[model samples]
Target: NKLRVGLLFGGRSGEHEVSISSARAIAQAISSDQNAQKYELLPFYIQKDGYWLAGEIAQQVLTSGTPLQLNGSNIQLPNPSQTSLPIPTSPYLPVSSSSSSAQVADVDVWFPIIHGPNGEDGTVQGLLQLMQIPYVGSGVLGSAMGMDKIAMKMAFAQAGLPQVKYMTINRAQVWSNPCVFPKLCDQIEATLGYPCFVKPANLGSSVGIAKVRSRSELETALDNAASYDRRLIIEAGVVARELECAVLGNDNPKASVVGEITFESDFYDYETKYTAGKAGFLIPAPVPESVSSAIQEMSLQAFASVDAAGLARVDFFYVEATGEVLINEINTLPGFTATSMYPQMWEKSGVPFTELVDQLIQLALERHS
Candidate 1:
């Protein structure tokens, strides 16, 4: 029997379009896979309105350039036990909602292709946990903590790992102590000095991030980042090269060959990341054998620190002059758009796209059972 795989995509996050792109890649990859005959891919799209719908209507909306017209309704997990919980009833005659007629999706497992908030931040994972469904990727604490830069750094620190110096700013603090942010930025200027990276504490794909070379640009850059997330993070700028490693599996995870990203900007930004004909990537980064080994070792340590499952792409900042390696960030769900680094690294290591997905599915099944 074909295993029913629900490939969930789109979300109420800044990465909605990015999620769509990921979904499209999965659609094309899985549908064309000859070995996946017994394991089907059912795309479940979560519209901007938080509606979950499958079938042709969802596909049309995904491909069409037209504005999203959600002709869809909400999707809630079905309780096979059909157990009822106590709820506030009318003072006089009690009325109950008809949940027995509720529609349910037949999914052996859920593959969340959505990124950033709402989905990747552990919100959806929590719901899935309550509903007792097996889904792909890390669990609640890992997802939530990994998604937030502040929390992730805390975990790294707890694990006795090396982390770049960073400071966090929340909206309330910024508003309450109007000078709080500027003062902290000034402190960063004094401590970490100029050319630090500013980003939303909970964003990926380098969205709403800036590299400030001077204190003058600090205020504007922070304000821009604070708009995207309630909390903003500023990391001590390391004048180094950006390298990444791909990790797979849960218990005995494996790391792939080291790769390098060369961006056209001061750092990897939104356009340099996803825009067509944008950034350039090099497989098996032209680095020495010893440095590559160290990076792979550190990548596994970081992945273990977060208790990450399924797969993640760990990024690091390497100072060539100093031979110092600093952990930049670890993405639990790095891009899987075929061209993305995670799959690319694994591909170059002899795991093609279709086989990569197959292995992930096997990992999912292995974890579930």
Candidate 2:
């Protein structure tokens, strides 16, 4: 009757470390929870080169504080009638050092703690869908839409929702015609104007994101962003409050208490977010009751619009001067560290962290069955 959950993390994406951190949280939290026997947190590592490291060594990686200088060269996903991606086998965790073969336990559920690019951009979700396994968060369409700011904004526009002015530029276009880059900038200047935020189309944790104030800054920002993703999006900066709400469930979802992220820097950039440790956050965002209700309502609607299931945290840009609230983005699978805002919001809303993860597993089975 127990569920064997594969907590998959540490993929080839730029957020590899973030994924590792998240996996540690899931493994520890699930293992220590009172309902531990109800589910098993199987350590599954997708190495930078896509090799599978299993058994106790994988578990050590999940629990250890030191950086892993993995000796693993690579792991292949074999096409098998019985398994999803071929079960990754490694020499370190084998029953005997003399044997190189290993067969991993069957996984009843998959918790992909990945945060960016190939991991969160629907590529992994498509594979999971093909494997006919019920995983958490959004489906392929929703995951893809949420990963790219361009497509997400397009969805907002189609839904008649307000979002900051922005445009997308492919790396191929930028490199294909260096002369055209300026022309493209000129067009953006004429259309959306200055003080833009350059963001990689499919990265998370504020990696490869820059706040640009002028044309000169835009070039450097775009180059930095292009290093992370082939598609780059530039948003005309707006002076708005950073507000976030957590959405849960599959069909009709519920929103958690609103939260505000106050950055000690100019904006919530990479340093302010994951490092620098200068930024502070406020629980139950300081907003009027009416505004809170409106935000929560809109957050649920946005989650539904994307066809998101399980969980998603919808972010919004609310400008106080204009009393305007615009949808900024939706994170289909947000940061899952136990201390992260998503888990915190639910915890404050009466669902404890372990209960939250347990509920997600139950939801996956409920939906799949």
Candidate 3:
């Protein structure tokens, strides 16, 4: 029998739409493959309002080509011994013994493509762990650590990785004592200075991220980011090229060819990242071989530092004037959208999309074994 693979996406995150786009891409890719007969694809979508969907409803929601609507029946998380997808709990819907009962999607492995909070921060991974199902990407610890910028930075520092100067801010402190806000500002100016980036420590896809060049902007940015996550992070800005490399595998991960991103926006934000024609990429980033080698080396080191598995995209800031390569951040579940850098880099490095997907699935199975 073919290996059954469950594809999970459409999370309750700020990146919900991005996740849907990624899911659509993966489905299309898998459907068009000549070797698709080697495996059975089972799609599972988590609605934004916290509904677990599968069966014909999921198939319709995914293929309708319309905005994601909450149209599926209620379902819950499965138990380890269940050996099947979550059992639907609602009774209002009509059911026929065989014609109307909800379908059960049992799989040998799970491929979670959900990005951002509840999904990417390890909550879903933890649930799957309890279910004893093998899933793609990082585990609970790595996913949790990777989702929080403060914790991720600490791990990188522990590994002796060079990164931009950064500081963490607690939302509670600012909200409790209004006077403490000014002191926090002074501290930020003293440490990171102006032209810094403020971001929610736990979210990704550039959600709740701001580039502030003045005190007023800093305060507003901090407040905005605080609204998303309790822990906020501020980093000193750097005028350097944005280079990214794809790392794949578990114990012995390999880095793909380096790629660079350039855009007219103040920074690479959500729009530039997901919107086509908004940002430009330089494949085999026009840098010296030494710089490329350094990025690759650092990428592998960063992957090992976080104990990442399956796949990850390690980003770096290459300062031309100083010739310094500083680690930016590692995305455990980097976007697989058409405009994403992770798969693009790997494709340029000679790994086609279909082959990359096959390798990742095999890696997931290998890790479980």
Candidate 4:
């Protein structure tokens, strides 16, 4: 019998469209003749208003390549802090039923492609954990740490991985005490200096990230990022190349070839990331063999440090002047879009897209067993 694979996407995240694109790509690959006989695809979509749409509705959205429009009643955009709303108390699973009532129980395995906030930050993984179902990517601990920049950096520090100097900011502290804001500014200017990057600790896809060159910009950046997540991160900016490596497997993970991201923007922000023709990439980055080997090693180390399983993409900053490689961050459920660095790097590493997805599914099954 074909393995029934449940593909979940369309999450209540800022990266909702990105997640849909990823699911579309994966669905196409799995439905291809190469794997068509081996697996049965079942898609489930979570609407922006936090409603679950399963079966044909999900298949229609994927087929049309657009989000479904629902009635405007009681529709509110999800707040970043309140992303993890309680699951519906329906008798059947949150996913709508078809002919039978137990739609979720029919699946042999799950593949969650949601990115950022609620989906990637362990909420969905926790739900699946409660259901005792096998799913792709990291588990509760790994997803939670990977989504929060502060916790991820702390883990990296504990692992003794080299990274840029950074500091954390709490939204409550800044709001509760007026005097706390200036203290934060003073500390940032004294420690991280003029040019630094401010990011929301619990979001990705560069949604709530900004580059500040002065104290005034830093203040505004903090307010902007705080809207997305309560925990904020300020990192000392570096003049180095942005490199990424893809890691696969569970017990013994493997790192793919190093890839570099080059962009015309001042920084790789949301626009430059999703917008076409804004950035360029160099697969098997134009670096010495030794540098490539070191990056691969660090990538594997970062993956293991976070207890990530199935797959992850470890980003780095390689300083050309000093030849120093710094671990930046890891994405547990990295983007799988055609242009995404994760799949592209693996493709360059001799693992085609179909083979890559197959290996990930096998690894998920392996870990479950």
Candidate 5:
């Protein structure tokens, strides 16, 4: 029998649309003739408002571009003894009245493509662990750490990985105590200086990130970032090349070829990352062999720093003038969309899309076993 794969996407995060695109790309790759014989695809889409969807209706919801209504039946993963498998239920699909027949088909593995917050921040991973199910990407600790910039930076510091100087802010304090704003600005200017980047601690796709060059912009940026997450991080800006590498596997993970991202926009924001033709990429970035090797090594270190598993895309800032490379961040569950860099870097390293997906699934099963 083919390995049953649960493709979970369309999460409750701001990256919901990006997750849909990722699921679409993944589904296309898995459904190809060569891969189709080896696996069965089951899609579980979590509507923006938290409703679960699957089967024919899920496909309709994805294709029709209609607002997902909560009226439909939601999916649930009951205790293992309650059902023979962890498959989600859908009102669109039929179920027999018998207890044995009420069970949905079992899935051998789960591929979570949810990009941010509730999905990638360990909440879903915790659920999967409770259900005793094997899933792709980082486990609870790694997922939680990787999702929070403050925690990730702290881990990187503990691991002795070089990184840009930064500081964190509590949204509640900043918003509630009006007097704290001036002190916060003074602290930021004294530490990171001008041209600092402000971001939500637990978001990706460049959401709620702003590059502020002045005290006024700093306040606005902080407020915007706080709107997305309870914690906010401020980092000193640097003039450097934006580089990324894809790390794969558990225990002994390896890094793929390094890639560079150069964009026409001021910085790699949400629109620049997801929108077509907004950014440009350089595969096997035209850097010295030593720089490339160093990045690949650091990529693995960053992955291990957070104890991440399955796969991650490690980003770095290469200061060409100083020849200094600083680890920026690690995306535990990077994008798998057609234009995403994770798969593209692996492709440049000679791993095709199908093979890359196959390897990730294998790693998930191996980690569970």
Candidate 6:
């Protein structure tokens, strides 16, 4: 019997489009002749408004490369004054008389391609956990740690991994204390100094990240980052080559060849990252064997530090002049788009995209058992 694989994508996060691209790539690979006889692909798309669309609708989104429009009359705007969180609903359960729980429950395994907040930050992982279904990528703990930059940094620190100096701020503190924002800016200037990066602690895709070189830019960056997530992370900028390594497995994770990211932009921002031709990659980065070995070792350590499983991509900052390799961050659920580094790195390391997805699904089943 063919193994049924539920492919989840398109999310409420800013990386929704990127997730769709990833799902398209994954679906093509899974449906390819190489593995078509072994697996059945079942797609599930989560709408931008957090509604779940399955069956033909989900398949159409993947085929058309467009998201389904939600009915305006059915949309409900949140209460501006409401402070309490809304009770969560299971996307796998039947939503109406026309829907069936078996659509999700009968799946042999799940492959989640959601790249940011609501999907990648452990919410979907927790749901899959509750369902007792085998799913790809990291578990609840790893996903949560990987998504939150502040928590991820703390985990890296606990593991004694070398990383750039950074500080965190809470939106609530900035809004309630009034003096907190200025105090944070003062501390950042005095410590990390000018030319630092401000990022939303829980977001990916560089959605709310900014490089600030002055107090004015710093204030603006903070406000911008705060709009996406409550926690904000400010990191000291460094002049170094950005290198990434892909890690795969559970108890014994293996790191792939190092890949360097070169961009003309000031930094690897959203545009530089997603826009084809804007960024270039040097596979098997021309670093010394020793440097490559060190990066590979650090990548495995970073993966284990976050308790990541199935797959992850660990980024680093390598300073050639100083011979310093600083850990940037680990992405448990890294992008799977055609230009994404994770699959590319693995491909350079002898695993093709189709085989990589096959291995990931196998790993998911292994982990579940």
* Maximum-lDDT candidate: 6
Best by TM-score: 4
Question: What stretches of model 2 exceed 4 Å from their correct place?
Answer: 72-105, 176-178
Q: Each prediction's TM-score against the native?
A: 0.86, 0.88, 0.90, 0.93, 0.89, 0.92
Q: Tell me how far the alpha carbon of residue 362 in candidate 5 is from the true structure, in angstroms, after superposition.
A: 0.7
Residue 305 lDDT (model 1): 90
Model 3 regions more than 4 Å off: 71-105
Q: Between 1 and 3, whose lDDT is larger?
A: 3
lDDT of 5 at 272: 89
Candidate order by TM-score, decreasing, is 4, 6, 3, 5, 2, 1
Off by over 4 Å in 6: 71-102, 176-180
Off by over 4 Å in 5: 61-105
Candidate 3 per-residue C-alpha lDDT over 235-280 given as tens digits, one digit per residue, 9 for 90 to 100 = 9999998999999999999999999999999899988887889999
Model 2: per-residue Cα lDDT over 1-369, one tens digit each: 877787777777767887887788777767875659898776666667765555555676677732355543232322222222333532111122212222243567877777887778898888777768878777799899888888888877887777888888888766657888888878878877878888988777788888887888887887788877789888889998899999989876889999888875788876677773577667789987777787898898888777778889999888989888888999988888877889888888888888888888777777677
Range of the 10 consecutive residues with the lowest summed lDDT in candidate 4:
77-86
**Better candidate by lDDT, 2 or 3:** 3
Ranking by lDDT: 6, 4, 5, 3, 2, 1
Report lDDT (Cα) of residue 214, candidate 4: 83
- TM-score, structure 3 vs. true: 0.90
lDDT of 5 by residue, 29-134 (tens): 8888879999988776677766555555555544543435555334333333332222364212222223432212355788888899988889888877776878
Worst 10 residues of 1 by lDDT: 89-98
lDDT of 1 at 247: 93
Please give the distance, in angstroms, between residue 113's alpha carbon in candidate 1 and its true position after superposition: 0.4
